[model samples]
Target: MKSQMLPTIFIMTLALSVCGVYSGKVLVFPIDGSHWINMNILIKELYSRGHTVTVFRSSGSWYIKESSPHYNSITVEDVAGGFDEDFLKMLISRIIQIQADGKSSWKRLQVEWELMKLGPVMTQMEINVLAKLLDDHKLMQSLRDAKYDLVLADPVGASGGIIAHYLNLPLVFNVRWTVHSEGHFAIAPSPMSYVPMPMFELADKMSFLERVSNVFFFAFYEFQAQFLIRPLWATFTNKYFGPDVDYFQLIQGADIWLMRVDFVFEFPRPTMPNVVYMGGFQCKPAKPLPQDLEDFVQSSGEHGVVIMSLGTLVSELPRRVVEEMAAAFAQLPQKVIMRYTGEKPSTLGNNTLLVEWLPQNDLLGHSKTRAFVAHGGTNGVQEAIYHGVPILGVPLMFDQPDNLSRMRAKGAAKVMDIFSVNRDTFLQALQEVLHEPFYRENMQRLSRLHRDQPMQPLDRALFWIEFVMRNKGAAHLRTESYKMPWYSYHSVDVILFLLAVLATFMASFVFGIKFLCTKVCCKHKSKLE
Candidate 1:
């Protein structure tokens, strides 16, 4: 009997260990491309912790797969006019053409105008997809029946918040950009004075002219959000969620904001209680490179290896630009690993290896890596900071320039203008980053600071996510400021009311003084008579 009891106890213990004490169902709605990459990391972690995860992706999604061991997938069908690879490539090509035309201010304005046009197109496409998902009665019913503990979303697309509100589930945002602007601009007290607008490439410590441009860019984004993006989302939310529902307010009402930024990368700014900085959460210690790659890297000897990747979307550049880049790489003593899919440049050197894709993090982590040549995406910048590798940035478009600007301001990077960069300029920039001690020193300092946290960024993000699920919602951490009207939230109405009271008091005091003078004069006149 004692032996039988021991076996039963062993079985119970094993079961408990495999399936943890608590588990919650999570529903993830993520944007595709690089954003999905970030979200997928969290989903895997959630699965490892004994929780069930479901991911929502469109049928035409480029990066997201239908099946994964980490989580189940929910594929929405017939997402028309979606932002696909071909479409993105065309847009990128057009932008590159415009930039390559010349570096005149007019050319710059044309680029800005072109980006502004994209605002309406992207917003409309997102709303159309949201409508299709919400209108599907069967899908809606299935989601409602699932009884998810919380809804995690990237608020770049508005459906996540709207659907979460519809299901009456707790909402958590893994965010950097909301549809309106940067996540902080939507929820925090962002003063344009110090907080530089995104994409303008201005630093926190701005000169007078820089601040003017900052405010101008702020207004430009505000106009796009108010006049372009908001109307479409508002129309959709009115139809599905009701006329009373405001999508912007729904976004602001989220339980937690796992901000994809930290002070080490972003400028210091005012933030809220619910805003958790998980900058570099997706980064980890670099693993060993594959054998072939390792052999090549080891062959770099004293000079070490240099890596170049232009993020996910913009893989290839114009042939002329590609040739110039190749020529520049040919001159470097350092071994070059470039992720390119374009035609091989005639100037390509034996030292440079052009692969379709390389393990970016692993290469950066290698001790042989001396510097990185990259298109400054958020993920790449954070990874470089994590690995303590300096950068020579060739920013292509949209937030890439701004991302590089921050690194340059921090003394860890040197940025080049894609429009004007020829072989000579490109070669000069790379040599500076490679030879300079300060660039390496500065980036290593940032890496030290980033790694010296009590909890890893990923762990902190996971803890807050679990905390929200356990408590049903993190209402205690979230502020009720979103409910207030714009005037009330800014205290404009209160200021007006105080001004009215002051005016009334001053008028009454003046009247009292006039009345006293009249009475005294009348008494004196009567005495004289």
Candidate 2:
């Protein structure tokens, strides 16, 4: 038996070795911070699969490192400043302050305006980087010479799509958001009647008033994209590409969009063929925790532990909010582990442990973890769903509220407005999630459903990426509707033409009947005479 097994093992090993040799070179343009976390997972996977990876990072990148064993880094010097931690922290604080003014229309607009300010800044930064990259003759020549197989990018910024177009490389997007709108809105048919726009925090099912609001929100974003955002990229687009080139069109024309979400987390809506769902692709079974953390988990005993983290961008909340949260955590019987960089809250209990960083995935996967208190980032929410941990969400900004809304709709989470959250309210929400069996049960069921797929989300994403590279592009899968003008794509012209033909036929028939009647009447009159 041993001799027979050795031969089989050798055969299998040889086959695996042969298969691994067919690797392609991938050029990555990733967004910094939490977005980088998702992109980095793919890069690591590609590296493990024996593919060569090269990362393009701005000189002032926040989270993206200059050195990584998984990929080579090409730093874009003096191009433009990438999003750093301090800038994000300040933005978050301002948004929070604005939100405290209540939910009146004027207040909402104020918040929107605050958020809208980022559009020009980020767009301009990306355009500057694109221009700088293109202007450098040596760099451009080297890029062309290297002949990368494809460009994998997060399209929150347009630089990647523009560069991909410039190089004529096959493009794959690791996307949730695009420069203009949500990823689906960029390519898929999103009927505003049901498909809620991002930031609205509405669910798939909506009331009549909600639908109206959805439409209004849709229009607002459309206006922002067209009038405000699109024009910023025009000068660069015209200079490098042609004047006829549309920047948004280049984004829509990507070969594949590896959307970082799945049906489990996303509302049921129309999606494109090339749009692959890879929700929780960064998730994996938790490894053993660090010894100190393990001791804490062991100390929880039967009561279990509650873990909290606001993700990479905004670790520290306002001092008052932190105090409120700390007070709430103090009331819980379960031990708490929270990630905070702010001053330690005076109300904080001995049961709660504050750390500068926590291993979120490992903590969530622990059997002792009772619930998660989070700010409703996609990565954190998906991880909770993946690990079967229910969430108590304090959605701060951006898609956070919307994400929490989905979880709440699914009965896997309970959410409260961060501005409205007090010690009592926070404790109540947390207690409900901790005490309710349905929360855990629903999340576990979702976890099972998410896990029951034939292949891992990451594996699916990798296969499609390789599929694109092997074929030079996934043009067959991508819809050519993006290339068509709006009237043509929507078939408005065809509908009008059909209507005109029908009208012509009707008019001809009426005229013919009238002429025949007139002739018959005249003949009758002549016979009578």
Candidate 3:
């Protein structure tokens, strides 16, 4: 009876606290495909908590039309054509082509940066699609009539900002990338002392060379954003929002920023009032695995199971690498369930099970699951950490190297370069992570920290969302530093002014001393004569 009464009382109290503060009409614009799940969890939770939610997203997004009564998903095609699909197909092709040419990680990094240099081209493509949406007379009318409480947008692309401006709504950015430069610039101080740039794969601590690379990469990011791509974003903004609007200034209109990063998995850094961390925010209880998968895991005996997946970004690994991993799995005692989108490279070993896709969270949650082999994507890494599963990270591109570096630094994972993957090396990595107690212990610690938040991420997000609605965009939360120019915000201008003053004073004193010394010497000479 006491247990029953306690839960009942808790529920009632929670309900009362959320009455007016948790419900509002929210417009969500998140990146489609793999990144969608991050915000999808928040959206579902919001709807369950009685918020009227509208999502402007891709047609192929996970959210279907019949998912909920409180939600309305506006497909990108209803306004613009099916550009998301086209973009993703192009992206995949480019990645595959680059992988073919890039024989080493350094070469791959250069290829990725080369793609980043095509920012203007990408920006123009986004602006073209979004412009069509804005020009849709009926869609614009409906959006204006909706009287949305707030706009939620992903900062990866410029379309969200343009849409938010067109609707005359307050904007909030949801960043899937842990170290998004633009998102960091929008909300608060991202000092180089702690903040890392994405272009260079850097961790929190840096040697002299790493720091030099960090600064250089930051200059590169600035070049892409300001000099190379700024003109494209500027043209779009001017064409739509008027010539008076500067892209940088327009981007600063974001009221709040929610980053899917936490101190547990990342290096601890200072964050602003408007900046919120939601790492492992997408983690939820796993549903039951299929009977087939369950049987496979249970059949592994006392050796446990290992899950290997490269995530959605990589459709398939190179056939040679796939065959090598398969051979390594054959030599292991543990049963492995791997996600493979391509044909089997070689005859499958009795210890391995190949599936097109598996319920990743469900597999991770299983007690029999002892290890993970992945490409070190943030979501995959976070999920592995959430489940307390040690990982053998085979990083390929983007933030994968940095994520794996941090994982290795934290003692939760081992990293093997994709280029260096042979049967011997792969098997050695697997043996180390599975047999080592330190790796499992570190993973367990990470899991505990990720879940030990004061309030759940969903509730925190809802609280801020409704807080913005109730306060008419929560302008109070915006830091004053957002208004400061780059030089003033970083104190570069003040430092220069102080240096100039000191130089002037020193010059004046030196002149005075020289003049007095000459006069004294002349007077002494005259007296001697």
Maximum-lDDT candidate:
1
Candidate 2 residues lying further than 4 Å off, grouped into runs, are: 1-16, 79-82, 101-104, 520-529
lDDT of 3: 0.76
- Superposed by TM-score, candidate 2 places the C-alpha of residue 379 at a distance from the truth, in angstroms, of 0.5
Query: How high is each candidate's TM-score?
Result: 0.95, 0.95, 0.89
Candidate 3 total steric clashes:
0
Clashing pairs in 1: none
Off by over 4 Å in 3: 1-22, 58-70, 76-83, 100-106, 178-182, 514-529
Local distance difference test scores for all models: 0.90, 0.89, 0.76
Question: On a 0 to 1 TM-score scale, where does candidate 2 land against the true structure?
Answer: 0.95
lDDT of 3 by residue, 1-529 (tens): 8988998999999988877454678888777666676777777777887888897765544423425565787765533344455566566656656665436767667676767755666566667667777778898899889888888877777666667777778887778442126356456556675567653557778787777777787777777677777787777777777887766564567777777877888776667777777777777677788998898999999999999998875677667778888999999999999898888868469999998888998899998999999888888898888889999998766667778888888989998766557899888889999998999999999899888879987677767766777777756777666567779987999999999999999998999999999999999999999
**Candidate 2 at residue 283, lDDT?**
94
